[model samples]
Target: MWDMNFRRISGLLRRVDRLDHIDRLDAASHSAHEGGEGFSARHHRGVFELLPGTGLTLPRHAGVLRFGMSEREAQWAVATLADVRGTWVCRAGWAFTACYEGLELLAYGDCVDLGVSGFTAVHLHRRGPRLTEPSAVPVVLQDIDLFGYPANEVLAAVEPNLHPTVRLTPPPSPADHLSAVSLSAG
Candidate 1:
């Protein structure tokens, strides 16, 4: 069992190093700028300034992508803003992730654990990229800068009462900072 767990973790670790796929991401970014087929021009140049209660709801949408939408719809929603990293299966469900400069968007589908289908959940991460730099896209939640502001400050600003429905997972350690600002499909 330990060996299996180790292997699974190893595979996950390998996937985390996406620097080698820079060309693919670059191509996607270029096409988005050129307004290539199926890619629409993003508003505010793809900087996602999210409103917590409106867009970042646990039972609803994450930005423009809504819960219960198909994987293709989710892809289309973020096509101009990110590079889709393809799909993978895990214990919780099947998921596809997309990458941005400093953010990562993960959408889940066909979740056996939850006995649900379609895109059930979407997560937005501030620490998604393994690179050393901060996110290129500015992600703001309720006027608080998710990437630019200090983690503790951001946390304090988005206290639980602010949006009782949204799930805010703080970093394990203070040094680690804010890793993700995510909401589940309630």
Candidate 2:
């Protein structure tokens, strides 16, 4: 199923390149005066930004868990966690987690490098003026039943640290499935 979905989306993206050719040409017209670069170059530039340095890294205490989970499951877990965490932090009346410069720089750098393929950003808020305060909310994991009885109840969980929450939302339908595939491929 995953393979089929991937193929379908890959085909669509390839089609997008063909379909957008005319638009690209039009965009290139405006750039004729600026050294005659084409639209594709402009598009690539718009999509990518270069960082001055290697960029920031997750804190020494921070860690990521990449276990024996399927790509879909990992995406779902991260997405759900970001959603719940955003709501929790918002209710607490604090700024979103991405406000930290270190985390922000790291996230943007990573996204630019990797194209933010399967990630979704969720805004988290908390009450108070102190930027360094810890969150009181606890991370939780829920079992998602992707199928019937004895379902693939993998332990999907979320961990909300000071970093901005970026996750992958579950593909709930055919359209979403296609979108997910297209995104992952890019």
Candidate 3:
């Protein structure tokens, strides 16, 4: 786990370094033009501002979901309703998709790095605000909110976090099966 975090940090540093080099190059080129508007420090700062997003470590905040359920507790509150669906909620501008079945947390996740692809990983992680506190690299969620955000915002927050629902297709109708049998007989 430590190695994984180290690798993530190292990758972000490399990206920041690369952006710095690019900004330097851009400034140099603009400087070469005598009368042209060279990239000012202010402008450079603004452009480089986007560079930090690549290193964003999104925090998974815990709060009542879209339906008002708090995650501050370690365990789910209701354990009887075995299979109720889950939902996403937001607070402090952060989104938390929580799965609570009858007051128990089936799962919760925050969509951070969507492009990250690797082997299946399952583990416990310290979910807190430190992840999004202005950095210079993108960190993957080691594992997998209710602010009444608009649909678009909600989708943006949770889309990356959701895995496609896995459900078996309903069995073919008995009538269809019988019809196939009759056809085969004919």
Candidate 4:
């Protein structure tokens, strides 16, 4: 299952890079009016690319599932891609909401393409007039792997709807059986 999912992620990342290239071209040709808001009104859209394993963290057992870019990147993407003058907020699953244009676009994740090395690409965008000083959205990036049965089951009782964090029993091995017999006879 892991292998299959890994492959799928890999393929998706390639497609993302290609699409970003196309988006860059589109931004260059676009001529959109900047809305009179604090947000920058540029014709270019920014593409945030995630490298595989980049979001992984150990103590929490959850990786950096999402990222809210630096102020510079955010402004760049919004101006280039979004036509209206508005502030863009990246919501869950890479979805962005532009307050001015009222536009929502879903950005997909591509960690698998990054492979073990992980991904690194410029989130393309065009410079636009600043509506207000660009500010980054405060995002509570959660670890996707730390949720569900594997993490929760071990911490609590197994329920029909809830998965356990730990495996209920370890698989039997020769050493385990031998120890059991020795203890029983003793």
Candidate 5:
């Protein structure tokens, strides 16, 4: 599983680099918006590319609060994610980001492609039903800050994801069991 997912992520890294070099993302949105590694068949549904120097933009999501963070906010968010279980730690265009993989699966496996650079984070969400309609809605975040962002912004982005922080605890390993047995024998 690890190797497979790693390969998948590695492929995504290369594709992201390819997309980054292009001049007009708008012109190349669909073509450059590469699908992910078998997460879904419709990976090219909608694409929102985040560029450098764009401070922060919150995509217009109906129920999901998808947005990038300031440096301080990003570091803090990392801490939050690090504590969570089943999170997808991503290397986006030379920066870092994480996703709640379990929650996504629970939510019918919605794909949220997030990219982070030294000073920016870009995201795209798939906003259509596979059986219902085959259309894509691209989301573009706005420039804002944690301090200036609307209330519940952080909450919305971080709340549904919080449950994972408790679910990723691994059970004791065989080595640990052996140590306990040896202690009892001694």
Candidate 6:
């Protein structure tokens, strides 16, 4: 199951790089104004890009944050981008949420399994879904604007490009809206 999801994510990465692969996304929805608010109006604080192996870049920050970073390093990374809202510790490792206004980042570290005592997962999300409102941060998965485009459009474009390994767990309907995206190594 895990391998399949990973492959699916890999497939998504490939499809996203293809130019204008999803027409609906290119249509009327691309505009922050037409769709609701353009990315410019959302007051985006930074742009984050996908990194190999469940990793992501932090704009204006020195290094990329990927799975296997130490808890301290992860916390420092998030702190540099936004305020650390809260943190939690468990038997396996630790987790925390950082926020830059409405944009939020969640990261988790693992002390066991996968043979690492470091971060294993990272996620980005809006404080809440406002349908037409733009996101505080834009998460670009390949070239697709995970938050800029409508949820339905993103899903539609992604579903078809999926490698047989991954499937949308419940298969989103035309109504689904994208609220969050995650990268994980475990």
- Clash totals in order: 1, 5, 14, 18, 6, 3
Which candidate tops TM-score? 6
How far off is residue 66 in model 3, in Å? 21
Local distance difference test values of all predictions, in order: 0.54, 0.25, 0.26, 0.25, 0.26, 0.59
Q: Which stretches of model 6 miss by more than 4 angstroms? A: 1-44, 52-54, 89-91, 111-115, 162-176
Q: Pick the winner on TM-score between candidates 3 and 4.
A: 3
In candidate 2, what residue range of length 10 has the lowest lDDT sum?
Answer: 177-186
Off by over 4 Å in 2: 1-10, 14-24, 31-45, 48-94, 97-166, 177-186
Candidate 4, superposed: residue stretches over 4 Å from native: 1-14, 31-44, 56-186
Inter-residue clash pairs, candidate 2: 89-125, 92-127, 93-126, 94-126, 94-127
True-structure RMSD for candidate 4: 21.4
For candidate 4, the clash count comes to 18
Model 2, span 1-186: residue lDDT tens = 743464365442222243245357666775776766555532332111111111111222222312222334333433332321222221222112232211121121013344333222222223343322212221111211111111112112222321122222333332321111001112
Instruction: Give the poorly placed runs of model 3, Cα more than 4 Å off.
Output: 1-14, 34-186
**lDDT of model 2, residue 29:** 71
Q: What is residue 58's positional error in candidate 1, in angstroms?
A: 16
What is the alpha-carbon lDDT for the whole of candidate 2?
0.25
- By lDDT, the best candidate is 6
Ranking by TM-score: 6, 1, 2, 5, 3, 4
Q: Go through the candidates in order and give the C-alpha RMSD of each one to the true structure.
A: 13.6, 17.6, 21.5, 21.4, 19.7, 10.1
Model 6 lDDT per residue over 1-186, tens place = 743464366553323343232333444355744755333222234566655465777755535787788888877877776777656645457888887657677777785755666887677777764745445555666466566555666676766664332222221444444666777664
lDDT by residue (1-186, candidate 4, tens digit) is 753464366441223333344455455444233332222112122222223323211111112222333334433444444442333223222222232222122222223333211111112111232212111110111211111112122123222422221112211331110000000000
Q: Per-residue lDDT for 1-186 in model 5, tens only?
A: 643464365441223233223324434554456542232212322222222233222222212212333334444433332331233334332333333221111111112343222333322222222312111222222211111112233224423643321111111331110000000000
TM-score-wise, the better of 2 and 3 is 2
**Backbone clashes in model 1, listed as residue pairs:** 102-135
